[model samples]
Target: MSLFNKALASIGIGSAQVDTKLEKDKVTPGGEIRGVVHIKGGNTEQKVDEIYLGLNTTYLKESNDRKINVPVVIDRFRLNEPFTIGPGETKEIPFSFVLPLDVPISIGRTKIWVSTALDIKNAVDPSDKDYLHVIPNRLMDAVLNGVEDLGFRLREADCEQAPYRLRKRLPFIQEFEFVPVMGSFRGRLDELELVFFQVSENETEIYMQVDRRARGLGGFLSEALEMDESNIRFTVTSSDIPGLRQKLETIINKYS
Candidate 1:
């Protein structure tokens, strides 16, 4: 059964229906979101105190308990109060809100739901939840472009379930995995993982881990293998986006 029907059945208001509409299907970070909520009274007269619109994001929590159902509030709106409508009364309320600039997105594609609800005190009703995919902003896109330009292909992406500290307050952290082009990395590295930590308004720290390939030598050949690898920490911090890409390429060349 539909959420509308379930809510109606739960509240004994088999006559009311709710619908929500959005101006755009996709919203950019730090952009405007505009939408309208529609509510119709069912077979009988009903008293509605107010209607509300909420922008929410939900994710799963992984811990000792390992349970799901995590919802965070992004924005909210309230409609008129103490409205009385006879049988079959239809009402539409318009709402607009600003998306926060620092709202975090999952590493890859992620679906987010926005809810618009009509609250008739003591009435059975369900809030409408609409799904949208959150895409990365230009700053992040630039970084990805730089990485690809350096001949690194995306391998995988994921988010950390535990709270990780970054310079920013965003509760989630995203990791991008990549494999360097042939002859780019030396020693026996199989893959490289790049994790971005936004430390401040203008600074980002790119943390990297190299997974080394197994060695056949007897005396820790991998540890003994010494190639002049350009330190990425120094390179990325001193360079612009393009400069960072160049530095990364240089590091890969030197390591290879």
Candidate 2:
């Protein structure tokens, strides 16, 4: 028996096993996830009371000057009928569900983890977890276009704890970074970090942080801005290209 099987055997109920298989290994938000749940009976025939699927993720929380692991449940599904399995009988269950577009993408690959388990009376058997990657749709493209048009290039992207409580409903934030195109300011700004929330068909909330580097004489200057359920993501426009270029010269004249 495998280590997992041994662990399950130690629980004292008849040994049970669970397996999960997904139809599409990759998907985008607003996509559907379809899979099968396989269950095997143990030494004795058992009354399989129920089965369930959990969409879970690990998030970070900061308090007391430190961060801690926090598990969040995005959604859950349960079987309504009780089935009986003969000794050593194998059973398969089918499942499919649509993923919410706003769901946070995993650290790397929008791939979220889905865990499935079975219940035999009070005994529980958990299957090995599966990872499914998600993609962002057209809405994401529209948002990115605005940023790129504003002289920012994609630098870094990741899911992290929201820095503030301004948006209470979202558990994770995606940060995108961009550098000022050549000759944009007095000194080159490091990069801009962006966060999006309340994403939908019509509008999305945007949060921006500008990282301005300090030079010889001037105090460091930086600004943070937030937008709630609005599409005002771009402040500088194409028409401002000429004036924006001039502003960079002044920055150099003043400092460097």
Candidate 3:
């Protein structure tokens, strides 16, 4: 029966199971994430060659003219070196990491998660997954509030594969789409799209694409050809928080 039990364990019939418990799932960009990895040995002793964790998310990529969701790892690290656990044994390993500054905010279908897996030789490895609710940090929150205060409502947000020129540390960019609701630009603009770039704790760069509302035949032609839009790039810092709305108004009104 020992040989049969070993065979079963080798095929993961009874192997180590991994579970990760986070200190808090609600996180901010560029924040600290604390957690513990609990490993429970099953019916037989197992040798774990490696243990790793990854901060992961998905972005939309276009392939053959069709959009497909692709999983990406923002950051990953190994928990410890090789180890072993006996049958019915439990091990608790604590971990901590700072979330990347460019991690996508969990809006729409943009989900960020942590994946933990154990590498077992000649066996099916066990793994665990936990989702994270990534919220805007202080500076980002201010930018969102300022935009809303300017009378634009958020339409949608998505993490899409970025163009080569606009690619930052990651291959994806998180875009915020907004439609004018009750602002001065409500009549002058069709929609305003904002993409944050080079985000950090203190400041961030923003790329704004202002699509102007078509007026006449010339405007219609230009719009149809994607020529009626204005692109503006700027940087916002913590010191700009107090006058952010006015600054944004000044910049947006110029092109509106």
Candidate 4:
């Protein structure tokens, strides 16, 4: 009976299982996440080689003129070393890690999650998944608020394949699209696309694409020539929040 149970366990019929419980489901970028991994042994003894946790998200990729969803791993953490788990044994491992400052916030179709895996020698690995909500950090929040203060409301937000110049550790970037309702940019601009880059604890860089509304014959011609849009890059610090609107307005005016 014991031999049969061990054989069944090796084939994952009654093997160990893993579950990850996060302290909280919502977190901000650059914040620390605390969690615990629970492992429950089953049927027979198991030799666990290691345990790992990974941060994963999906991004859009273009292939053959079509966009397809592709999985990307943002980061990974090892939670344990080799260990033995007797039948019916249970263990809990505590864990903590810092999220990347540039991680995409969980908005629109963008999703982020933590995955835990238990590696068992000569047996199937057991795994668990827990989704997380990533919000903007203080600096990013301020910048977003500044944009809102300028009368731009978030129209759409999504992660898509990045251009060569914007590629970093990941092949895709998150874009926030906004449209002006009532502000200095209302009449002249059609929409604005914003992308954050090189985000850190102290500072971050921004890329803006200003799309101008066609006004007259000249404007229509410019639009037809694909010249009605302008791209700008700027850097901002936490202190800049006080005058963020003014700085952003000035930059927009330069292109207008």
Candidate 5:
């Protein structure tokens, strides 16, 4: 390699480029993602130390008494040993990964994506970004449907900072807020909030919070702003799919 070519590669004028192609961008939690990483050589041979992929998203974090969005990597995967690509060379690498159950659902302002990059010494690294549309899995769909069947309307969904106790691998949790539209709890309750955590492929834990209607209008409004409270969870399995509604109703009724 000539000194001139090395200098050009260092400035990215003749450095390798990477592009990622996903077989499918829309996926559900606990689903599989398949894709291909294409690397094209520039004017000179470049050494790629490593290639990596990160499953990334953002969550609200309290900083200086204000909420700030911060990036979080839910999972990551790294490829094999160092390799060199000769001038005008082309290479294709196939990759795949299973989505983590704890990955925040792509709802509201939550955005999920896969970041791909190649680490090259003394040169600008090439990268690619592909967004993912994460949908609810079978177990999650069952719970969501169960709530709607009970005359509750989903008001909002968000990924926010998690309490120490409820947190596991991730520092945040996805919350679903609901209001009684035409149910027995309409006047008796103010709102209902839920959180889900999947411990395995066949089982999941649901956290619940029920807010009661206060005495006066002012009280109700004030209580709406304060949704924080001690939470309770129910451990349910794939076998419970048939009776999920009844079980959820039983749990919510106890609080109502």
Candidate 6:
């Protein structure tokens, strides 16, 4: 009977199961995430080799002139060591980690989740998944507010395949698109795209692409050739928020 149960467990008929419970489902970048992993033993004794938790998100990749969604593991953590569980036994492990500062917010088509896996030697492993909603950090929030203060409204936001020059640890980047509704450059600019490069508690680096409104035949030609856009790189600190609108205005004027 024991041999039969072990065989069944090995084949996943009655293998151990795993479930993760998070303290909170919503968090901000550079924040801590706390969770617990619950494991229940199967019908027979099993030797658990290790347990792992991974942060997962999707990114776009171009292939054959088509965009394909690909899964990326941003970070991972090993939670436990080898252990033994008897039939019907249960165990719980608590975990906590700080999310990366540049993690993209959960907006639009972008999604982020945590996955937990139980590894059993020569047996089927069970796993659990928990999704999370990531919000902007303080610095990022300030920057966004500054943009709004400059009379630009957020038009769209999404995570897409990063350009070569901007590629870092991840293969994708989050873009915040905005258009001036009632600003000095409202009539001169078509749209503005902002991408955060590095974000910290005190400072952040930003990349701005300013699209100028087309004028005549030359302007139309430049637009078709991607020459109508100008890219600018700048860094700002917490103290810069107060004058951010004016600073951005000056930058846009230069490009316009």
Task: Rate residue 10 of model 2 by lDDT.
Answer: 44
Candidate 5 structure quality by residue, lDDT tens digits, 1-256 = 5789889999888889899999999998889999999999988989999999999999998999999999999999996689999988999999999998898888899999999999999998988999999988888888899899888999999889999988888999999999999877678777889999988768889899987777678766756776423357789888999999899888888866
Q: For each candidate, what TM-score against the reference?
A: 0.67, 0.69, 0.97, 0.95, 0.92, 0.94
10 residues in a row with least lDDT, candidate 6? 196-205
Q: Per-residue lDDT for 1-256 in model 2, tens only? A: 4555445554745666788899986776667899888888776555667788878676667768997767666777885488877657898888898877566655443347888867665455545688776655555555565556556667667655775664455576667766767444314565666666544434455565655565443333222232211212333333434454353334323432
lDDT value, candidate 4, whole model: 0.91
Task: In candidate 4, list every pair of residues with a backbone clash.
Answer: none
Write down the TM-score for model 3.
Answer: 0.97
Q: Which candidate is the best by TM-score?
A: 3
Maximum-lDDT candidate: 3
Query: For candidate 1, lDDT tens digit of each residue in 1-256?
Result: 4566546644766656779888886765666778787877776666776777666664456767775646666566776676765667887778787766545554464446677766666666557788755565555566677767766678877654435443345445456777767444534465666666544334556666555554567424654663222224432332365476666665554544
lDDT of 5: 0.88
Q: What is the C-alpha local distance difference test score of each model?
A: 0.61, 0.61, 0.92, 0.91, 0.88, 0.89
Tell me the lDDT of model 6 at 168.
92
For model 2, the superposed segments whose C-alpha errors exceed 4 Å read 1-14, 107-111, 145-155, 168-170, 179-188, 201-203, 215-218, 221-256
- How many clashes would you count in candidate 6? 0
- Per-residue lDDT value at 22 in model 6: 97
Q: RMSD to the native, candidate 4?
A: 1.4
Q: Give the per-residue Cα lDDT of candidate 2 at 77.
A: 83
* Superior candidate under TM-score, 2 versus 6: 6
Question: Number of clashing residue pairs in every model?
Answer: 1, 2, 0, 0, 0, 0
Quote the RMSD, in angstroms, for model 6: 1.5
Per-residue lDDT, model 6, residue 153, is: 91
Model 2 TM-score relative to the real fold: 0.69
- The positional error of residue 201 in candidate 4, measured at the CA in angstroms, is 1.9
Model 6's alpha-carbon lDDT is: 0.89
C-alpha RMSD of each candidate structure in angstroms: 6.0, 7.4, 1.0, 1.4, 2.6, 1.5
